[model samples]
Target: MRSPKDFFAPLALGAPEPLREVPFRPSRMIHFFDPSNERMRAKVPDIAPTVDVLLGNLEDAVSADSKDAARAGLIEVGKAWEPGHTQLWTRVNSLDSPWFLDDVWALCHEIGDKLDVIMVPKVEGPEDIHYVDRLLAQLEARVGLERPLLVHAILETARGVANVESICLASPRMQGLSLGPADLAADRRMKTTRVGGGHPGYLVRTDPVPDGDDDARTSFQQDLWHYTLARMVDACGTAGILPYYGPFGDIADPIGCEDQFRNAYLLGCVGAWSLHPSQIAIAKRVFSPEPAEVAWAQRVVTEMGDGTGAVMIDGKMQDDATVKQCRVVLQLARDLSAADPELAAAYGLETA
Candidate 1:
């Protein structure tokens, strides 16, 4: 391991100054809105403060004819970003797309200062990040932009998931990882038709059913993306960045959406994608630990001073491992309290 003093040295010559040692600002929900859509574009000012990150999407949901329009829309929306309450970000088209160059020029050249991070989709490995890193630096230099733009990689392909560690380490501008379950499932040839949720057929069932009584069988469902999310979280945490669970398409089922986001939150993901206005509250609620949970975590920490040895809290065992878990909850709560008054209130924290 490198010494503490050497930890923040620049990762590459032209890469953004290292933000590795800085604490990740809270982004509990990176709300996705198509910049090309008029209704969505209109919602930016209203929703910007409500979300931790406002992503003006320029890929996938955007049609070919709207590519230029999307770029223009992003510029308009980015320039109006609310600094602390919500960050302004834009998802550029894939690297191979014809419009990718134009998208970069519009956002990074025009309103780069207002933009926080640039989300790159279909990231297969570090090489992709390296290309964007170099290009972004060149553009920043060319445009005389003061601050370096950060990068957030979308792990949508199987290859991206496999190479997440390298991608996160590829640049100092790296912000976090977001799991794109739709494309990931397609790439992996998964049998699920729904976007980012458990399939009915994909579950665990009691074996044999008590002497072959098949009619009495009981089944237990599982989150199909658990493995990928876990891998992403471990990699992001290792790199000292953030990890988020991307979109849940079953918007009508708030329960399932909450459950999915909650599971990801418990498993170390810092936030998730909110595709609709309705889903934003769910993501926020699930990502922030409940007041009851915060209380218990605080109790454990108070009992385990110096963060060693063991203690008992409410008849449950609290040891080194448990203390570590409590620390995670408390730290997130404390950091989230800095900007989010609602979240601070939810976690029983005082806010000014």
Candidate 2:
């Protein structure tokens, strides 16, 4: 194992030095699009400006026969694309897939400069991250990439969730972790077929109504992925990396999608996957701090001047801990506002 002093050192000769801290950006929506599809490829330029991160999907959705086309298309997109503030990311095939090596090889050599993060699917432990980290260093060295490409692991398999903490701390290149709900559910043998959102059957009933009719008892749907999401959040927080909620498959159910996204937002996820264009608005709305919430956080920070002493604000107690929480909200607003003028106005961050 490498010593603490060498942890941030380059893994390969001539490779760029590792980052000391994972930079925080406005990644409120990881909007996915298949690069192999001509129509989708056509829309990327238009879509890139609207989303915080545009991910070129070369796996799962792209059929085996189309994988080559998808990779080439992504390279083309990367070369032509101009991502002002939006990040360019891609979901390469799982490390075990036959196409993985070629995918990494070509992207690193051809478009390493444009690419931001590589989302590796089915990562089960720190070992997987170590392999990717070394490989990325070698490739970055070959291409003379000035900036190191970050890796984002998808928490898909049961094993991945089990080793989530280790995975987050595996490498300095670890940008974040995204909870892959559908694959994780399947791996965990969960009965629900839905990709995300609450399952009515996975909830608790109102004490069976005691002596009253059990049929009349109210049943409130609890979040199915709450425990896992919370655990992932804590792990990511401990590692100082970002956490994101994966895709919600039900595109038709906008309300349910919004609910799932909101739950993730409240539980510390910075963003979520947007499989459909319609989900973009939902993610943006849910992930961003509301105007009223920003106002409240601002009030708390203003009243708790220097963020040291205790004070009462609108009948609520404000302390050092609460001020830190308020700062988190305010900082997110400021980051989002930097890229979005309308959001700046909403959060009252607009300067004359």
Candidate 3:
């Protein structure tokens, strides 16, 4: 392990200095597209502007036969597309995969300058990040890239979840963690086959009507991934990086998708994965603070003045703690509004 004094130093001789802080941008939805799919490749330009992060996926969904093509396609995307406000990222093959070496070497040497973050899948521990960190620094130094690329880990396995804090603190390049529910479920041997949302079987039922009518009892489905997501959020907060919700597979069920995204948002996730085009709007809507919420936060900030002492707003307490909460809401609104004009107008940021 490196000494604490050298933590922020570049691992490679001439690599750009490690970033002191992981920059927070508008990452409401990490929209995934299969780079090998011709139709998907054609729509990238149009989709790039609408989403906060566009990820070229080369892992999991990409078949073995198409992995090379997907990598090449992502390189092409990096070359051709100007991200503007949108960040460019890629999900490379896992560390254990045969394609891992080629994927990392090629992308870093080819379009390392354009890539913002490399999403490493199935990262089980800090050792995985340490490997990627050194490799990225070497590649960045060799390519003479001015900016060091960041690393994002996918919490896929039970082991990954167990070592999450170490993974987030592994390197200065550590950007964030995204909960990979499907693979995690398989690894932990969970019964459900769903991706990232709540399960009906995992629920709470109201007590029987005093044994009068058991059939009249109401049951509410509980969030299957809540505990894990909350833990991930806390780990991320402690590390000062970002936390995100991974894919919700039920694309046909947009309402359910929104509900799941909102749960993550409220739990402190900055964003989620959007596997389908329809889910893009759902993510944007769910992650952004509502207009009414923004208005309420604005009122609280105004009422609190210097964010000291206590006041009462609408019969609710407004103290330092509550003002801090209001600031969190307003800060998110401000960041999002800077990129989105419609949101700025809706949040009254245009005037502010």
Give model 2's clash tally. 0
Decoy 1 TM-score against native: 0.93
Q: Which ten residues in a row have the lowest lDDT in candidate 2?
A: 202-211
Report model 2's TM-score to 2 decimal places: 0.98
- Which candidate order results from sorting by lDDT in descending order? 3, 2, 1
What CA root-mean-square deviation does each model show from the true structure? 2.7, 1.2, 1.2
Where model 3 places Cα greater than 4 Å from the true spot, the runs are 209-211
lDDT of prediction 2: 0.94
Going through the candidates in the order shown, the clash numbers are: 0, 0, 0
- Residues 279-301 of candidate 3: C-alpha lDDT, one tens digit per residue: 99999999999999999999999
Q: What is the lDDT of residue 177 in candidate 3?
A: 96
Whole-model Cα lDDT of every candidate shown, in order: 0.85, 0.94, 0.94
Task: Give the per-residue lDDT digits (tens) of candidate 1, residues 1-352.
Answer: 3355754554445444556553577788999888878888897778888888888899999889998888888888777665776788888999989988988987877898898899999999999987897788788777767667888999999899889998988777788889999999999998877888788888898888456878788989877988999999999989878899998999899999999999999898999999999999998888887889899999989889988887777789889999988898888888788887777877788875
